[model samples]
Target: MAFDIYDFTSLTSSIHEGLATFLPPVGVLIAEWLLVGISVLLFVAVFGLILVYLERKVCALFQQRLGPMRVGKWGLLQTIADFIKLLMKELITPNKADKFLYNLAPFIVIIVTFMAIAAIPFAKGLQAIDFDIGVLYVSSVSSLGVIGVLLAGWSSNNKYSLIGAMRSGAQIISYELSVGMSLITMIILAGSMQISEIIQAQSTGWFIFTGHIPAVIAFIVFLIAGTAETNRGPFDLAEAESELTAGFHTEYSGIKFAFFFLAEYVNLFIVSAMATVLFLGGWMPFHVGSLDGFNAVMDFIPPIFWFFGKVMFVIFLIMWFKWTFPRLRIDQILTLEWKYLLPVNLLNILLMTLIVLMGWHF
Candidate 1:
């Protein structure tokens, strides 16, 4: 087979075959599992630092102020310094907190993030696990993080923490419907839940363009719902610093707190990645009909870059929402979802179904 640096399939297959040649079948399985675990751990650690730095810079740009100039060139090492500090700090638990559940919450939250990340396709054949029900698998796993939030808050024995956790649970539960309906709308259009197949269906053109108005609506709803699901700002009633201090993880300190912090940025990445795969065509290069020259130029860029470029664009939009909007009142947040987004999302789903039935979509 011809080598393509952009596609990871050949590299991964060769590794597997080479290992099989020297190792027993069980040993091969064990080796692959070890490799995957280490890769995920390393990626999470490095990407978490990058995202924290990116968020600082992005927020600085919005506010017209310098960010992170003291640590390294342009303060690039700031997050790494902070990470090291967190690692050295003490993991403090509240004296009154339930020790077992309190300690378990952060692990639960971060583990769910890793599980959801496994299903996302970073590039061709680069995914850790590819289930037929990839979308459903992701949705189910990602939603479990809220349980950890609740556990942290309730186990802390703090009223503020409990309130924040309760708020997060309600917020995530409500907005999840909008997120699912948006994906279902696309699934109706694409006719597959497998993430790879969904991307392949966009070989000619992205669904956002081909599916037209309904696709646009679903995209909007998905972004809004995704932000809410991640407990991010504008919908961050759960983490109202003025009202609830540090919210659900208030009692957590040191590396435990870092886990929660890391999970937030990683969750942000996952949400953007899902948006990219569903509406922005995953790793597929952009193409305009009958423009072979332009299409060929686009294809010259690696698929992995296309995938991450789209992911970063969507991440910026989510970050913009975070920095720009005022946090909504808890009631307003719930009302926005139940009254406005949810109803519009339900209608949008029906519209997409009709479009599919009538063959109106490209």
Candidate 2:
């Protein structure tokens, strides 16, 4: 049978239907759900490795040095070697640590990231889960990682760990407002919180184009706040290695440490994916009404390609910030969020409201 790359739901439905013919109904259902989970897990694992390598290469390029080149073809297998080393390392806990919470934090972080990416559509009709309030659901679930961070810090019985966790909590809570408000500016314009629907609304033009300057401003705020929300530098006060000695996860080690490490990159993926879906147009190719040939050429590239292209671009932007900017002081981070981002986001939303009401978009 011919496959339609864009009609992902249809393909999955077909597979489920075919399996149901041989397998018991319960087995088919279980298999389908399990496959979905496995696919997402694999994506997270692979993306985490790729992101680590990419960041190293980017940092090397900026610093005029060689990155991982000996492990595999151009150091492609370097992350794999590092993963093996991390996987075999010891899982240590402090003598006075609260065992339960200290052990559970990393799992919580990983689970939240898995839940978040499920709501994000990679291609048309390709999300693992669908909800009317996709935006709200993703935001709420993703923010719950802070609980794990706080627990990890507090349960470690280390004053430094506690300090790091508190800083993380403050930073995430502060920046998330900017992230949500910035996204909402475009959501208000899109008039739907369903992520796929949001992308569909951008068929003629992306929010970055349709909503114009307000959309551009919203994207910038989201990028900055989203970076902070992920505990990434220059907003990486939570895990300030120079200050707190690895932040909330300082007391964590081994496979447990790997979980926290993976979650950080996965969180980065979540924000970048959301940016693609919300502002840059998820799975939507660039098109111009006046350029039939150009639009046709773009259509040939496929939706999945468009999705990843935009996501990678945003990820690169985040990495650039991490490498180029100096880490902000805790006060400076809060000041940037509360004083600048929050106010600008509020005004951007207002401007979007006016533009939407006036039907200014094409």
Candidate 3:
């Protein structure tokens, strides 16, 4: 059967009914729990693999090269090979490092990333958890990633690692303001924080289109903030190889290092997906105003395709920033955030509020 967002609620009601028919209620409950847990685990594992491969290919295409060509046709097996390599490699800890924290940091980062995926609506009625505070939940859960980075950096006891952690912490805090404000504008327009409701609000037209000028401004700010939040591209001073020598997890090796790397890419996917959901309309077909045929043609494509297409488009823009721009110095990075983005984003939010109040949106 296809994934159903309402399955958990339905399952709960079913369990109650099952109790009336069966003598051993405990067994049925246990079985259902196991099934749900296993399904979530499998979904995460598969999604992680596919996302990694897709990112590689996307990056490759932008750089005028083939990403993966050997393992599976067009290098599809590259990530699998990388996974095996990580698994086979020996885990190493520095002599002076806090062994416990060093090993735990990666898992913490991965856990936070995986948790945020639960609220993402893959398609109509396909979300894992449909909470009222879905947007806020995502923002809160994502911020926890910086903790893991800091732990890894501090525990490693390397100067570069420490600097990387500091930079990451600062960057995340700075960008989070703009990202949150951008999301706030969407929430204000939608009049709800639920991911499903947000998507529904875009049924008539995506927020990017409806909110018009202010929405476009917020979108750009969000994109920039998100890129920095994920520690990608020009804002990736935390991992600047020429400066920090691999950044926060510099001393980590084998599976430990792999965890940090995985977390980074996973965060990238999350940010892109969030952008798709908030501005481009998650799982909603594109519609040109008053173009019935075009809208119908768009609807023929599955919601998931629209969702992924928008995400990939955002990802391409991110990769473009990465390849085209030079890395900003740490001081310059802070200055850009406080001096430019913060002020512009604050003004954008005010303008958005005015636009919404004036009913200027189409």
Candidate closest to the true structure, highest TM-score: 1
Candidate 3 or 2, higher lDDT: 2
Error of 1 at 19 (Å): 0.9
lDDT of each: 0.94, 0.91, 0.84
In model 3, the worst 10-residue window by lDDT is 1-10
Q: TM-score per candidate, in order?
A: 0.98, 0.98, 0.90
TM-score of 2: 0.98
Off by over 4 Å in 1: 1-3
Cα TM-score of candidate 1: 0.98
Across 1-362, the per-residue lDDT of candidate 2 in tens digits comes to 33689677788888888889999999998998999999999999999999989989988987898899999999999999999999999889999899999999999999999999999898876898889899999999999999999999999999889999999999998888998998799899899999889999998888898889999999999999999999998988788889889988998888899899999999999999999999988999999878989998998988998999999999999999998999999899888988999998898899999999999977
lDDT of 1 by residue, 26-78 (tens): 99999999998899989899988999999999999999999889999999999
- What candidate 3 gets wrong by more than 4 Å, as runs, is 1-37
Model 2, residue 143: distance off in Å is 0.2
Cα RMSD (angstroms) for every candidate in the order listed: 1.1, 1.1, 3.0
